[model samples]
Target chain A: MFVIKCPYCGERDQTEFSCHGESHIARPENPNEVNDKEWGEYLFFRSNPKGIHYERWTHDHGCRQWFNVKRHTVTDKIIQTYTMGESKPEDNNV
Target chain B: MKYSLLNLVRNSFSYHENWQEAWSSPELKKEYDIIIVGGGGHGLGTAYYLAKEFGLKNIAVLEKGWIGGGNTGRNTTIIRSNYLWDESAALYNHAVNLWEGLSSELNYNVMFSQRGLFHLAHTVHDMQEITRRGYSNHLNGIDAEILDKEQVLKKIPYINGDGRYPIMGALLQRRGGTARHDAVAWGYARAAENLGVDIIQNCEVKGINITNGTVTGLETTRGSVKAKKVGLVPAGHSSVLANMAGFHLPINSVPLQALVSEPIKPILDCVIMSNAVHVYVSQSDKGEIVVGAGSDAYNSYSQRGSFDMIEHIMGPLVELFPIFSRLKMLRQWGGIVDVTPDRSPIIGKTPVENLFINCGWGTGGFKATPGSAHTFAETVATGEPSKMAAPFSIDRHYSGALVDEAAAAAVAH
Candidate 1:
C-alpha cells in the first residue's frame, strides 16, 4: 500500500483517496464549436503514459478535496501532489 | 517430438533422457515477413496461426521477457464465451471452438477442462442482469442456462447460500472452464517453432519504424529487424507501444490482482463468480483455490495493487465460502490490464498502415486467446479485418458504434 501526500491533508493512505483519472482535461469552451471528432478526442483520448503520468485524485476520507498528482506509472512513485488548478511541475523527476 | 502415448513409452525406456526442448530459442533474424510484438499467449498464438493458417513463414515473435511471464501466466485461467453481445459471443465462442482442439492442434496437452462456469447473483438486479445476458447469449447461439439457487447449491455444495447477500440465482455456461495458462503458451510456442516461426526471448521492441505511413521494421533491445507487417498483442502495455507508433489508444493500464490458497484436497470443481462480491473462485488441478480481484483504483504499470483492495475482496470471498477462512494465501500477484472505455477489444489495422493491433481485451483476454490470434492472423495476412473482428475495429470509436460489454464484464473480469 502506498501513501499519497494530499495537498490539503499531509500524507494519507491511498485508500483514503479515489483516482479521478487523467487530469488537466478541460471541457470544450463551446459545446457546438468543435466537430464530433474533436469532441470525442477531448472526452475519451488519454496519454496513459507508461512513465510519468499526470492524474487527478480525490481524498474521499481525509480532506475531501480534489488535487493533481504527478506520478510515475511504472514505478508508482508520486513525484508531486499539487492543488488541482496548479500547473504541472517543470521538473517531473520520479 | 509429438507428445503421444507411444512417445511417452519410448522416452520412458531411456529414462526420459532424449526429450527435446518444447521450443527452440533462436537468434533474431534481420528480416521477417511478419513480426509479432509481446510474446505472451496471444502473440505466440498469433504467430502459430499466422504460419499454420495464413501460410506465412519466416515470422518471429519478440518478447521482452520469457514467454507466458506476463498476464498469460498471471490470470486466473478461466475461459468463458457467455457474453451479452453478438460480437463478443461470436469472438469468444470462436476461441472456445479453437480451445476444444488447441491441445491436439498444438501437439501438447493444454489441460483444458470443460467444467461449467457459474455466475452467482446476490441480488435481484444481478439475477435480472444474468437473465438478460443468458437470453442474449442464447440468441447468439452461445450456451447459457439460468439456474436458481437450488441448482447453484447442487453444483457447489460448499457455498453459503444464506450469507449476508443470499444467493439468488446464476447464469451457467457449460462450455466455460479453465485451462493451463502456461501450457497454452508453451504449446503454441512449440507448434509455432515447428512451423518455422522464430521465438525470440529477451528482445523488446523499443521503437516502431514506419516510413510514409506504412510499416518498415522495429528497433529492439537486441537490434533492428525489418518487417513488412507488425502485429502488436501487448496486453497492458498496448498504449506504450501505440505511443511509439505515433498514435494514442483510449486505453488505461491498471493492476488487476489475484491470489491463490495453499494446495489442499480438491473441493471446488467448478468456477464460481460473484459480481456483487467482486471475487471469482476456482480450484486448480493441483488443488489450489485461485481467487481473482478487481482492478486497483488507479492506473498502474507496476504490477502491485493497494493492500486494502485485497482486504476488501477477501471479506466477500470468505463470506461466501466460510470454509476458506482459515486457508493460507500461498501467493498473491497482479497483472496489468489495459481497459478500454467500451470494455471491448480493438482488433485490425491502425492509423499507420501495416501496423496491426490486437489489444484492449482488458481483464478477460485469456479466454479469447485462440480467437484473437486466429482473427489477428487473418487481419495481418490479408490487410483486412476478418469477419469476426470487423466489429472491433478502432474506427468504431470514431463512429460511436461500440459493442459495449460493461454489464457482462462487471467486476468478474
Candidate 2:
C-alpha cells in the first residue's frame, strides 16, 4: 500500500485512498430526457489520448471528496491538482 | 398445577425470562437463518444491513478465511458515481450519498475521506470524452470539469510537462474519495455482531444444502447450517460457489495486483488514474504511495501478485511521474477479482428460489459497496430485484441487457 497525501489529511497509505477516474466530466439531468442516440454515445465513447491529458477522478478511499488532477502520460508526473470550480489550464501546444 | 405455574410466570409480566441456550462448541454449531457466502465487503456489509435493515435475525456470514480478508479488504478502496451508464450511474450516485453518511449511519467509523480523483487524458479525442461524460454526470447530479495544461501543472506540479502525449485536458470529479478497507470491514463486522449476526470466519462452504434445485442450507467446514434464504456474496470465488449450486455464472476470476512505495513525506494529494498508462497512483495518509494496475491476463485464484504487473507498470508510471523513480518499493501483492462480461456487478436473484447472489464484482466493485449491499439485501429479503440495481442482474446476460460502461468519456478510458 502506497502512502497518498490527502489535500485535507496528511500523507497516508494508498490503502487509505481510492482513485476516481479521469476527472472533470459533467452528467446530464434526466437520462430519459436524453435520446437513445445520445445515451449510446455517452456509453461507448472516451478520449484515449496518447500524451499529456486531462480527466476527472475521486479518492474513494481517502477524503471521500472528488477533486481534479492533471497528470502526464509519458511521465506520470501529476502536473496539476485542483478542486472543482477552478479554471482550466490555458491551452498549451504539448 | 403445571398450567397454573405457566400462568404464574405469564402473570409475572413485569420481568422477562432469561432462557439462554448455551452451545457446545464452535465447530459443532450449525444452523442459521441466513447463510451468506463470501466475506468481502459486500458479504459482510450484506450481513450488517440484513440484520440492521431487514431485521433478518439468526444470520451467519460464512467466510472461507477471515473477514475482509478477500477483495473486500484487498482492493484499492476508491468510490465514485461518475459512471456513464444510467442504470449504474444512478445507483452509484446513491452509493456516494451513503458513503457520505455511512460513518454516522452505522454508528461505526468507516473513515470515508473524499479527496477527489483526476483521470488524465493524453489526446484530443479524450477531451471530447470528458465533455460527453460530463454531460452524463450532470444528468445524474454529479459534476466533472475539464482541466487544461497550466491548471493541471498548478495542482500537480511534479510532471515532466513536456506533454509528449499532447496533454489536452481531463475530466474532474470533485467529490470522489477513499476509505480504509480494513476499517470498513471491521466496522461492519462489529456492528453486525452487535445485532446478533454470526460472522463465522475460517468456515468454508464445502457443499450446497439444497432441496430440489432450491437451497435449504449448506454444509460448511464447520458443520451443517440450515437456512431458509441464502446469498452468495463471494466475489472472486463466485463462479466456484455458483458451480456448487449446479448453475453456471458468466464470471472469470482474475488476479489483480497492486504495490506501494515505502513511507515518504507525501508528494501527491489527489488520486491519479490513466487508461493510457494503465497505472493508477495515489498517496495515502501514512505516506506510502499505493500504485495499482489492471489484472493479469491469466485466469486463476492465486493471491500472489506477480512482479510482471509491477515491472510492466514502471514504464507508464514513471512516464507519468518521474520522481517516483527515487522511491523505494515496500510491498506488492495480488487479489482475485471476479470479472463479468460487461464489467458490471451481478447483484440480484438467481434461478434458484431463496438463493440470492451478489457476485460478479469485477475490478470496480469496491466503490459500489453501499449500493451493492442496499440492493442485494432487498433482493434477498423480499426475493425481488431492485430497479436501481436491476441492470446488474445475472439475468441480463441471458436477456441481452448488458450495462456496458465503456463510454461515459471519463471512466476507464
Candidate 3:
C-alpha cells in the first residue's frame, strides 16, 4: 500500500484516492473532422507503458480533487504528484 | 513418453528413477511456418491445435521465461462456461467441451474435476441479474439452474447463508469446476512437441520485424528468427508487444491476486463465487482453500497487489464461509492481466498483416484456454478470423459491436 501525496491535500492513504487511468489524453479538437480510425485510436488505444507512467488520480475521500501521479509501473513507486494541469515530470530518475 | 498404466507399472520396477523430460527445449530455428510468442497454456495449446488440427508443421513456441510461469500458473484454476452473451457463451462453452476430453487426448492427467460452480446472489438486484443470465445460458445450450437460499445451504452445508448479506439464491452450472493448471501447460507442451513443434525457453522478444505493414518475424534476445505467420498470445504484455510492432492495443495491464490457505481436510467440494463481494473460493485437490480477489484499481506490472485488497476480500470470504476465518493463508501472488474496456477477449487478426493476437482475456482467461487456442489457431492459419473468433476482432472496438461480458459474467472484473 502507498501513502499517496495528493496535490490538494497532504499525505493520505491510497484507499482514499481512485485512479482514473492514463492521464494527458487530449480529446481530438475537431471530432467531426477526424477519420474513424483516428477517432477510434483516440477513444480506445492506450500506451499502457510497463515502465514509467503518468496517470490521473482523485483524492475521492479526502480533498475530493483530481491530480496526476508519475509512478513506475513495474516497481509501483510514485515519483511525483502534481496538480492536473502541470506537465509530466521530465526527470527519469525516481 | 506416453503416460499410461503400462509405463507407470514398468517404471515402478526401477523405483521410478528414470523419467524423461516432459518437453524438449530446442534451439531457436532460423525460420518456421508459424510462431507463438508466449509459452503459457494458450500459446502452447495454440501450437498443439495448429499441428493436430490444422496439419501445420515447423511451429515454435517462444517463452521469455519458463513455460506456464506466467498467468497460466498464477491463476486459481477455476473453469466455468456460464457466460451470458451469445458470443461468449459459444466461445467459453466450446472450451468446456474441449476440457472434458483434454486429459485423454493429451495422454496426461489434468485432473479436471466437474464439481458444480455456484454464483451466490446476495441482493435482489444480484438475484435478478443471475436469473437473467441463467436463462441466457440455457438458451445457449449451456447447463444452468437457479437455486434458492435453502438449496445453496443444503449443498454447501457449512456456508453462512444468513450472514451480513443474506444469500437469496444462486446460479449453478453443474459442468463447471477446476483443473490442474500446471498440467494443462505441460500436457500441451509435450503433446505439441510430439507433433513436431519446437518449444524454446528464455527467448525474450525484443522487436517484431515488419516490412511494408507485413510481419516477417521477431527479433529476440536469443537471436532473430523468421516466420511466415506469428501469433502474439502474451498475457498482460500485449500492449508492450503491440507497441514494438508499431500498433497500439486497447489493453491495460493490471495486477490480480489469488491466495491459498494452508492445507486441511477436504471440506469444500464445489466452487462458490460471490460477485457482489468480489470474492471466490474453492478447495484445491490438496485441500488448500484457494481464494481469488478483485484487481487493484491502478494499472501495474509488478505482479503484486496492495495488502488492503486481501483485507477487503477476507471480510466477505469469512462472512460467507465462517469456518475459514481461522485458516492461515499459505501463499499469495499476483498476475498481470491485460484487460479490455468491454471485459472480453480479443482473438483475431491485427493491423499488421500475418500477425494475429489472442489476448485481453483479463480476469477470466484460464477457463477459455482450449477454445481460445482452438479458434486462434484457425485464425492464424487461414489469415482470417474464425467464425467463433470473428465477433472478438479488434475492429469491434471501432464498430461498437462489442460482446460486453462485464455486465453479465458471474465473476467480478
Top candidate when judged by DockQ against the true structure = 3
lDDT per residue as tens, model 3, B194-273: 99999999999999999999999999999999999999999989999999998899888998999999999999999999
Q: After superposition, how far is residue B186 of candidate 3 from its true place, in Å?
A: 0.4
Kindly list the per-residue Cα lDDT of model 2 for residues B70-169, writing each as its tens digit: 8877777777777777888887888888889988776666878888887777776766766777788888789787788677778886865564474566
* TM-score for candidate 1: 0.98
lDDT of each: 0.91, 0.72, 0.92
* Model 3 docking category: high
Name the weakest run of 10 consecutive residues (lDDT summed) in model 1 chain B.
Answer: B404-413
Score residue B116 of candidate 2 by CA lDDT: 80
- Candidate 1: give the clashing pairs: none
For candidate 3, the per-residue lDDT at B307 reads: 81
Top candidate (lDDT): 3
lDDT of 1 by residue, B46-161 (tens): 99999999788889999999999999999999999998889889999999999999998998899999998999999999999999999999898999999999989988988999
Model 3: colliding residue pairs: none
TM-score of chain B of each: 0.99, 0.90, 0.99
**Model 2 spans with C-alpha error above 4 angstroms:** A1-94, B1-29, B407-413
Tens digits of lDDT, candidate 3, A1-94: 9999997788999989899899999999999998877887788888899898899999989889999999999999999999988887885686
